[model samples]
Target: MQCAYCTEKAVMNTPPRCKNHFVELFEKTAHETIKEFNLIQEGQTLCVAASGGKDSLALLEVLHTQYPVEALCVDEGIAGYRDTSIRDLQAYCTEKSIPLRIVSFADLGSKSLDELNPTHPCSTCGVLRRKALLQYSTKYDLIATGHNLDDEAQTILMNILRNQRQLLSRIGPKTPAQQGIAARIKPFYLIPEKEIRAYCLLKQITTNFSECPNVVKSFRWRVGEELNELERKQPGTKKNIVTAFLNKHYVREEHKRCEQHFCRRCGMPASNELCRACTLITIGS
Candidate 1:
């Protein structure tokens, strides 16, 4: 097939674009998302919540072009998986001369995620990882994440399926800063996951392609699979879901109703007396 914009052979099927055009589209989408949401402000410190995956690394690569960015990684201590990814992350950061900070479950005085033995591994790890990010990223003005369109769509559907109204309300391209938590931004909010992988290849960014060992067992994995299937059958299904959710008045109203309190144990933002991370850690202990 030929490229939509040029006679060069196409490399991506989504838009029938050649290598150069696909790369252009991917970076343009990310930059537009940031500008549309005002995700980054001038003279503000930015730290990317990188996981050494294609998505995060791709985000880091694009953002670095415009801003002085640092990388903050959370090690869930998932033995073979996280260790390999972190190695790739370290190498990339070193080559780029970007500052990198890594915090592990052990650093939080909890067992590694592999050793946590929780009923829901993803849920347990997510809470702890979020806490680790927020806890250690206080110095930064914003914490950027690599949540793409696919991830955002899956999260929206998952929250709706589980009737997690509060979480659904919190969904967006950027989250405002609360009392104790730093604001978070998602510059790749409109980019597809496939484009991110392709961008990494084109940019020669190093990333581990392995999936987390525990992902297959999570509710999100199931939801993501279903969403992918739907997206396959119906192009733009994921985008429509995110767009509708974002424009819905109910989500905005729900977000206003959502209240935040400090966890008694860690003094971080929480809805209850103890933050989700502290509660999960206590349960695991």
Candidate 2:
């Protein structure tokens, strides 16, 4: 195969990148995405949500080369999975001398995710984890995630299909800052997951490959499976879908209406009277 941007022979397949130019293309795309969205700016500290997975690891490695980044890990208290990944994340950050912080389910509430109702564990876990990330990120400029093209596309389709149009309003490379909330950004928003994996492979960045034990119980698993099949059949379908949404002005206008307000209970940013995390944590506690 030939490189997508050049005529030289290509070494990577998914959105094709040549060995000689793949790394350049990968890092260039990452930088361009950051600049395009102003994910990181002068005098602003960046805290990456490092999960020790390939995407997170790759994101940390790439960003660290250009900026001083602190890492944060959320331990959902999955007995085997989170413990193992935490070790990997810890080792990577320690070896690189980057500051790291870890918060757990126990720290947030009395019940660990394993103890929660098995039905829709991710729904509950997501609220908690997101809240933990955002809550801890209260001091930082923006909370960056390794959300690549594939992840973004699946979420867009899932939200639309679920009639959660409100969720689509927040879809973009970077979310504008709101009261009592740190802005969230996705530097890899336009990058393909395959490219990230390949970048990790090429850079020899070691990351945990273990799947989260709770993944099978999540709605994302089903949506991801279907989207993967669609992507395989129609290359660029994912990027096109997401790019179209990103370029649409009306969607963003509606998203802006999904405003933030302080939770009456915990005084953190919340859409409802009680922040979802605090609500779930209150139940779990």
Clashes of each: 0, 1
| Residue-level error in angstroms, candidate 1, position 90 | 0.3
Top-scoring candidate (TM-score): 1
- lDDT per residue for candidate 2 within 49-167, as digits (tens), equals 99888889888988998988999899887888888888888888988898999988777764788887658888888888887887788888878899999889988888988998667
Say what the RMSD of model 1 is: 1.2
Backbone-clash count (model 2): 1
Error of 1 at 106 (Å): 1.8
lDDT of 1 by residue, 17-116 (tens): 9989988888898899888889888998999999899988898899887899999999998888889999999999999898999999988888998788
Q: Highest lDDT among the candidates is held by which one?
A: 1
Instruction: Specify the poorest-scoring 10-residue window by lDDT in model 2.
Output: 254-263
TM-score of each predicted structure versus truth: 0.97, 0.93
Off by over 4 Å in 2: 1-9, 14-16
Clashing pairs in 2: 169-255
